[model samples]
Target: LAQEGQFRQRSSSCHCVPTSLSMAVRGLKAVALAACALAVAGKVQLRHSSHKAADSSLHVGSFVTPLESKHQLRVCNAFANSAAMDVFRGAESLTAETPMPYKSCRDFDAPLKSGDKLEFRLGDASSGTFSVADLPNNDAVLLLVIHRHDSVSGAVSFESHVFAALESAQVAVIDTY
Candidate 1:
């Protein structure tokens, strides 16, 4: 009778652990679902900092257009308030009237030269303006868009940074067995 009681107690305790684990898993699923719903509804806001790339060296396989050569502009949309962005060069829209989505990047086919002006628009509102002269004298240029949202006043602001890299020397190809 004593051995039977001990076996029953151990079995019951083992069953209780599984029950607790199931409840914990269910709770986690519920939280994940709630977060997904918020993102789908566009209620979630993203905040990012505009910082230059840590490694400035151009990789061996990567190519960089010389400063004297034609240049292309790469824009990264980090703005979270709106779903998409519109890029304008003066009165012309570079994105062909389609807004670039948030957290996505676009490369403009048109070349950017010094003294050129670029306007960043979110929906119908203009977020910020950037000048080509703001970029460094490096071979390639990347435009990073950073934004700040004011919850109190319901306002949004944007800032852009230029990350450029210089052309590195070509690595000599050596045939090895």
Candidate 2:
């Protein structure tokens, strides 16, 4: 036969080229495990909708007492709200704080009066909106609203030690992220 049918058609096309490269490496590992299980179920549904919108926008007499020297504070980021606002001021005025580890706190519908001039919309869409006015009608502001599944290096190492201990007690740190 003509050279044994060309050696059985070149050994069945070299065994279908390693079985088509092992089915394209198992279809690229099943599309990378279904895109890592849909990115861990969209970060667990954005951490349960940012803990139910930070327990209904933190209201326990909306405490505010932390100002030692951020040069009499004023931070801005007022309007394209996805989540990420960390404005802390502390040098001495603290009546009883420490209860905000991150849970969507920026989409103010209305009702945060005290020379209200807050508007920060920056979660990450090429960040844009920002407006913060002179907020120091007797200092004591600590608004730390960060979302997107927080834990960004433990909220930037606890806001970089609360912005270097409120800039070494110069206290006016208006950070709008």
Candidate 3:
């Protein structure tokens, strides 16, 4: 009788070992499947958000100066009383009295000073120009110059979040194309 009882105990223990291994394998498979599902869901969410951002329009207010007109102004660096050409853009208006309406660079020959405030027009309106004096006052300025071939469907692209951060920190951005 005792031998029969011992044999029954050994048989039950052997059966339990296989059952526990099977349960562990099933648990591992379930965990793997859950991880895969989470990864797929994350990728889908990322794709959706990117598509939405690309389709959205970013409005940068009326501070950008779009150089679409024929009027041009060149910003030159005068070193040792000699001017080296730095940047050139379409000058809209310096003031109410002096409005730049020249068609070519040869026609407009006015020199620019360091602290000169030149008002330029972007799209269809006037925009402000930032200088060294504006920096001392902790004023933030966003300057965007769109080139002919550097636009998407005639619209200039920029990262709005980065500009927002700079605006929040009072750091002026002078973007030139």
My TM-score estimates for the predictions, one after another, are 0.45, 0.17, 0.21
Question: Which portions of model 1 show Cα errors greater than 4 Å?
Answer: 1-67, 136-138, 149-177
The CA lDDT of each predicted structure is: 0.53, 0.32, 0.31
lDDT of 3 by residue, 1-177 (tens): 000000011122233235667689799989987986777677666656666556665332232343321212232111111221122233533333433332211223433333544333343443323231221111112222212224333322211101111212332233323
lDDT, model 3: 0.31
lDDT of 1 by residue, 32-143 (tens): 8787666644422221122236744433321333336444566666666555888887788998757788777788766666566677777677776665554444354444
Ranking by TM-score: 1, 3, 2
Report the CA-based lDDT of candidate 2 relative to the real structure. 0.32
- lDDT of model 2 at residue 150? 38
Best by TM-score: 1
lDDT of candidate model 1 versus the reference: 0.53
- Where does candidate 1 have its weakest 10-residue lDDT segment? 1-10
Check candidate 3 and list the clashing pairs. Answer: 66-122
lDDT of 2 by residue, 34-80 (tens): 98677767766665566665474532221234444332222223222
